[model samples]
Target: MVIYGVYIVSKSGGLIFNHDHNIPKVETEKVFSFPIDLTLEYDPKKVSVAFGQKDGINVGHILTSINGVAVNGNTTEEGNDVKELIENEGNYPLTLKFSRPKMTTNEKIFLASMFYPLFAIASQLSPEPKSSGIEVLEADTFKLHCFQTLTGVKFMTVAETTQTGMDVFLRKIYELYSDYVLKNPFYSLEMPIRCELFDANLQGLLEQIEKTGITNI
Candidate 1:
């Protein structure tokens, strides 16, 4: 559960920095649980919720506005407004509005098979990763668990199932990065990070996980 890879994205959608922690040098067996993917169509600007799950988020609705900003399907806002929203959202409750799509009986019956796992192209959408929790995707050879951020960064691990608290974990990483990396006067924007404090904190996270006996699957 402690495997981590973090990177920062730029406004133009570029990855200017990354920090890796405890990447596996050897392959291992993967485990997976039943996953319910609730996304239709892969536009980050437009999000949806899918129906039918045990512990579902019930995200089977169309995204309307976030933080009072209307998503008018306008490209003009991408550069200025969207960029600012992604980068400078400092510890605010993200308020989102959504509308559900009317579904046909046949569509509802067949929707279960349309689970959208992490596609290969998902990584290239942003220059940096986004703010997302960890989820498991059953691949051909293995089930991969990933921690994805909305800006285009993904922290992946090969495991049996996805775990919760990845967002909480990542926010902790960001807080430390903002303090030890961004707040550091010598740290240049988007440059490759070489911070000892960040590394030390990351290492501490690994130690904490091991000490608590957190199971991987």
Candidate 2:
């Protein structure tokens, strides 16, 4: 089954946070304890949370707390008290009561495909890189990394980057494109990839780069 959950990570390779809401409807009244898996190197302070609500359902408001603490709006609840809760970490079961339930497989797939175009637009809007960072080595060759991935499309040409840089750029591109663009509902695959808002924002970013006389990098 397509498990739905949220994962938070740092720029560093740290799986700082994780939560899986796999409770069946029949067990709604019952409380279940789930383990918070963290990487040994995970430092909670420098982490950023990335939330995925199975098919973009607005479950943010539904996340609540009966005991312990609940951090809403995509940030861990701060303060020394909150840290104390973690120090006493054990099987903490937060009762999640919901009105609407889990989605079916067909529903999830349809939602995922609908947002695929955002990826395409992102790829199109990324500025061509310079010889150092991103460059068109030949008529059919182009270098791409985070720029292409955030937009959710891959270049038709090859990008030759040092193995390390390529890895970093690819990982970032995958994460952003998958989370931001692919999870959106208004996006669709049948339609042409055109994001007026992203275009406008990207134009502004390009203009800023131009002003600095660093357009190609």
Per-residue lDDT of model 1, residues 163-195, tens digit only: 344545555656666678778898666465678
Best by lDDT: 1
Judge candidate 1 against the unseen true structure and give its global Cα lDDT, from 0 to 1. Answer: 0.46
- Find the number of clashing residue pairs for candidate 2: 4
**Local accuracy of candidate 2 as per-residue lDDT tens digits, 50-135:** 34333222232232232434433223355333333333537365433212334554554453343234433444667853312222
Best by the TM-score measure: 1
lDDT of 2: 0.34
TM per candidate: 0.37, 0.22
Please give the CA lDDT of all the candidate structures: 0.46, 0.34
**Every model's Cα RMSD, please?**
21.5, 19.2
Residue 132 lDDT (model 1): 38
Candidate 1 local Cα displacement, residue 172, angstroms: 0.9
